[model samples]
Target: MWHSLVRADNLFGPRHALTAVHQQLDVLQGLLEDSRGEYRHEVLRLSAQYAESAAWLHEDSMDMASAETWTSRAMEWAMEAGDEAMLPWTLFRRSQLAAGKRNAGQTIGLAQAVQRHERALTRPMKAAAIQQEAQGLVLDGDESACHRKMDEVHEYAASVDSSGDARSGHGDFCTPSYIEIQRANCWLNLDRPDRAVDTFQTALAELPDVYQRDRGFAQARLAIAYVGIREYEQAAAEAAAVLDMARGSGSGRTLQEAVTAGNALAAESNVPAVRDLLDAVKESAGF
Candidate 1:
């Protein structure tokens, strides 16, 4: 059911997907409560994965309370499973959510917690921590600290070869391409549009074809970068691509980012592309 919902090429599909995932998780919670014998390790693992999924879905929906609840559950299940990889990765998701909320203090605290628990973390986990720290620093307007964290990310990435354990974390957490995308976003948030554009292009070069949502997000950030640089034409092109990708994705986070970018462009009345994007946004509701 999860596969079918995720594979469906429409907005309703993703909406249904979220609902199905949540329902499945409820069933799993019931089973966990009713279990009589020794707890199954696989069940614990599934619980962790489901919790992580719920947290992600909640974050996408901008439901911070739900997101935090699921993240806490995910961490609990991961610890129960003795799944070190899951712990840091889940924390990383929380940090990202905190960053989205512009809670730089919370973001940095989460990232620091992950780093303090680094003995259990894999190289990719370390990279994620560094990326989150960088983002927090960016939000706090600590340019030097952000750059320092970015450097740490590069150092961590350089230390690991491509032949390490493939399953470092749950889901797509272990992918280098994912790390690159996060790094690109950090650059964007730091107001380094040129660097953001370059990093995003690098991410696209190595990124797989499966994660359309991630790709769409990168495109949206790219649009913002273009806007930052006064490249209205390129920004418009990227925004159009983002709109096309978001048409049926059911990703509230992406839609929100697009709306924010569009609203920012509203100040530039002389730019036709900006006016057009703003008009498009005004015409659309429920984003």
Candidate 2:
């Protein structure tokens, strides 16, 4: 269910997936309240997952308070589950929320705090923490430190194997494609869109089609890189790809990036593809 729930976040986006999770959680929560035998721990485990997913969706939906509430609830259930596996993950999500808010210091602090619990972390979670710290460094405008952190990310990436744990985090997909995409994102944050464009293209091509929604997001990032370099034609084409995928996925993230790219292009000279992409972006805004 965790696997499918994460997939739904990528495929159908937050707003759509949250509805399903909420329905399932309502029943599960009730059953959990009554059960107190062998299955109690199991229910707690499942409850933790549902709460974590809800927190993620709420964060994406721009409901920070709800996100915080669910995240805290997830931590409680995780603590009851006794494995303590979800502790690092819950902290990781909080770091992500800080990053989303663009609070670089808070992002770095939370990510560093995750690293402090290094003994409890899985390999995948370690990689995620390092990458997140790098993102914070980028936001701090520390190019050298950010690049160094990415090197750390690559080292951990090599240790990453074909394990299910690698795929648990919301944005941290734990595939090689995901690493490549993060590399591109680093370049993007560092304002080296020229470098980012190629890396993003590589990541997009390498991404497993099973992660359908992720492909859309990579395309949107690629489009932005193109726009950054004034390669309006390529930007237009990439934006078109994002729009096509977003139509199927209803990805708010994809739509948000598409809107940004479209507005960027609007300021420059116009082409038919550019105009078409912009119009399509406007259409998807309703999603």
Candidate 3:
């Protein structure tokens, strides 16, 4: 069931994946209530996993309130189970949600909290938390500090044993390609869209096929990068691709980025491609 939920998120995107997540959460809750001893601990861990999944789905679907609720629940279950790994993971997840809110202080604080659990974190987990903290630093306008932390992120990520403990289901996406993609986003935020365009193109080329939704979001970001450079034709093309993915997958994250791309192209409204893309984005926004 958990594997199915993961596949659903990858293939069908968040809105569709959320239904399965909620169903699994219901089952986990029932099992957790009646569990005892070691079995109870296992159930609590499972509960935390499902709750985290729910939180992620909600976040992807642009429902921040529900995302926050489920993240807190996941944290509660992780702590109750004394799950060393998941406890820090939940804090990292909270940091991600904080990033979505543009709360740099909260994002940095929560990511630091994750790193504080040094003994509990896997290498990938450590890299992820540190990368997240670096992103928060970017938000706080600390460019040099962010780059230094990003260097550390790469160092930790390089040491990850792909075939060993690093392959553990959680935080497995912290690969070199993923790290590069994140760096591209940080570049975009730092107002270096030229570098972002170059980096995003390279990272996207290496991204795994299983991460379809992530690809969609990345492409959407690329569209925004094109807009930043006044490349209206390229932006329109990329936005059009993102709109198709958003329609098929019901991805609010991708759709929202498409909207952002369209808004950024307002000055190029006279261009035929930009006009068409804007129309599609406006129509999609209604849904």
Q: List TM-score per model, in order.
A: 0.81, 0.88, 0.94
Clashing pairs in 2: none
Q: How close is candidate 2 to the true structure, as a TM-score?
A: 0.88
Candidate 1's TM-score reads 0.81
Give all candidates' CA lDDT scores: 0.71, 0.78, 0.86
- Sort order, lDDT high to low: 3, 2, 1
Top model number, lDDT: 3
The sequence of per-residue lDDT tens digits that candidate 1 reaches over residues 99-140 is 888999999999888888767776666877887888898899
| Ranking 1 against 3 by TM-score, winner | 3
Worst 10 residues of 3 by lDDT: 158-167
Candidate 3, position 65, lDDT:
94
RMSD of each: 4.1, 2.8, 2.3
Q: How far is candidate 3 from the true structure (C-alpha RMSD, Å)?
A: 2.3
Candidate 2's residue-wise lDDT over 37-78, tens digit each?
669988988888889889977876657899999999998988
